[model samples]
Target: MGLVGEVLLLPFAPVRGSAWVIGQVLNEAERLYYDPATVRAELAALEEELTSGAIDEEEFDRREDELLDRLEIGLARPAPEN
Candidate 1:
């Protein structure tokens, strides 16, 4: 039954392939987002931008808060299986 459905959808294979690729990209992006090291690197970069006056106080505060929130959520979640 599943094989028949795949055969029927074969003509739209490229579309399905594109969707699969997009899903993979999204998954990787999410994993990277919750990564502690990545979050720390972003925090350091944010601080650098703020100190260099690349970003104003308001922008820095908002982004800093967002990053901190991510950190908190990531830490609270159970560790993922390797």
Candidate 2:
């Protein structure tokens, strides 16, 4: 299904399905941030969707939060940054 379809279906979807969707989205965001080269492009696309009203502000903030958290922990180096 397309993104709009997924968004529309998210709320009404089963608990497990909603969780799965959230997880999938988080993973994608993680991927984008772990690689800076794609971060700007990917985030810009998400931002565009938000600006165009394709996604609500709450959803945008939730996803953005998840992305930042994942980048902080998952992408962290073994040693702390200087």
Candidate 3:
């Protein structure tokens, strides 16, 4: 953009910056949420909860299915470039 264009858009700079920041935060959150290692850890914890009777078979099965789905999806994702 030319100097004139930049100047004209100056008033909206804050809104643009906020949007960029929100996008970055969302990307990072998704990366973490779909991480295989993180999902595996959660699965292990869930198993422990079941063994300890902290959760019943019904609850364990529901949560385990969700974690397994997450693991499958995470594994299917293409690795991110550094």
Candidate 1 lDDT over 1-80, as tens digits, reads 69999899899999989999999899788878988888889999999999999999999999999999898877886787
Clashes of each: 0, 0, 0
Q: lDDT tens digits, residues 39-61, model 2? A: 44566887999999999999999
Q: How does residue 12 of candidate 1 score in lDDT?
A: 100
Stretches off by above 4 angstroms in model 2 are 1-33, 73-75, 78-82
Candidate 1: worst 10 consecutive residues by lDDT? 73-82
TM-score of 2: 0.44
Ranking by lDDT, best first? 3, 1, 2
Mark the regions of model 3 whose C-alpha exceeds 4 Å error after superposition. none
Best by lDDT: 3
Tens-digit lDDT string for candidate 3 (7-26): 99999999999999999999
The candidate 3 region of ten consecutive residues with least summed lDDT is: 73-82
| Model 3 lDDT at residue 79 | 91
TM-score of model 1 (CA atoms):
0.70
What overall lDDT goes with each candidate model?
Answer: 0.91, 0.72, 0.96
Error of 3 at 1 (Å): 5.5
TM-score of each: 0.70, 0.44, 0.92
Instruction: Report the Cα lDDT for residue 24, model 3.
Output: 93
Better by TM-score, candidate 3 or 2: 3
